[model samples]
Target: MELRQYLHAHGKDSIGIIGVSWAEDRFGDPSESRLQRIAAFIDPKIPVVRETDDLVKAFSPLEQVPANFVYNRSGKLIYGDGSPKLMTKKQLEGLLAGSK
Candidate 1:
């Protein structure tokens, strides 16, 4: 949720959140819950694409655009690990600030 706020604060209308399905086994549902929290915290009207369980198993979104790395208009990686990194609210804020 915080990440969405940070991105909005920086004038971005959309930002992506990526997670591996395996994360559920390691981190539990709180991770997905957190995304929901962030959506509620930021813009309830915004869209969130959650890829998990049958959603991911049936559709491989990551196979097209992995996670973590930020892509510029030209398709260049700007920040983040080339894959998603579990981040805290503060870390997400810092990253959003850097993107600005």
Candidate 2:
């Protein structure tokens, strides 16, 4: 929530939010339903990108749920962490500020 608030206040034009899911049905619920449940917690306007098995493998090394990646204006991956919870508001703010 802090990330959302910080982005809304300072990075509105600079940051782009995208949610990626591998669409695994291991939980018995459909990926769409899982995404819907997730959407209930966040702003619905945020676009969710569904990645295929190959795409998921290509984009991230962890191959785990809830990976976060931050890219700068020039499309360079400046920050990546396995857990979004590990990143603090100030750290995100600093990353954005330093990227510029």
Candidate 3:
């Protein structure tokens, strides 16, 4: 499952991983059928958020693709980078634990 691979099998209780898709930027708004098709391949426990105005507050200054954002359990942005696979689950768990 992409969810398992993305989080290295961690991420539960106070942690989770979600995929954000910007396909609408070029392909146009997502239809129910289109979202359903994409969801078919993903684990039902994981969510893929389609781009929308609702995202402006959290991801307004969007820069580049394949980006990574790590937010703490409090919904605070803790780490961000222009690259993917920046931090391991163990590292994140330790960091977040100390933050509390």
lDDT, each prediction = 0.52, 0.69, 0.61
Q: State which candidate has the highest lDDT.
A: 2
Q: Among all windows of ten consecutive residues in candidate 3, which has the lowest summed lDDT?
A: 1-10
Q: Which candidate is the best by TM-score?
A: 2
Q: Please give, for residues 1-100, the per-residue lDDT of candidate 2 as tens digits.
A: 6656676667555567877766455445666776866855655667877667786565756545556678899999898855434566788889888999
- Point out where model 3 deviates above 4 Å: 1-14, 27-44, 81-85
Better of 1 and 2 by lDDT: 2
Q: After best superposition, candidate 2 residue 33: deviation in angstroms?
A: 3.2
TM of each candidate vs. truth? 0.39, 0.74, 0.53
Q: What's the C-alpha lDDT at position 11 in model 2?
A: 56
Q: List the residue pairs that clash in candidate 3.
A: none
By lDDT, rank the candidates, best first. Answer: 2, 3, 1
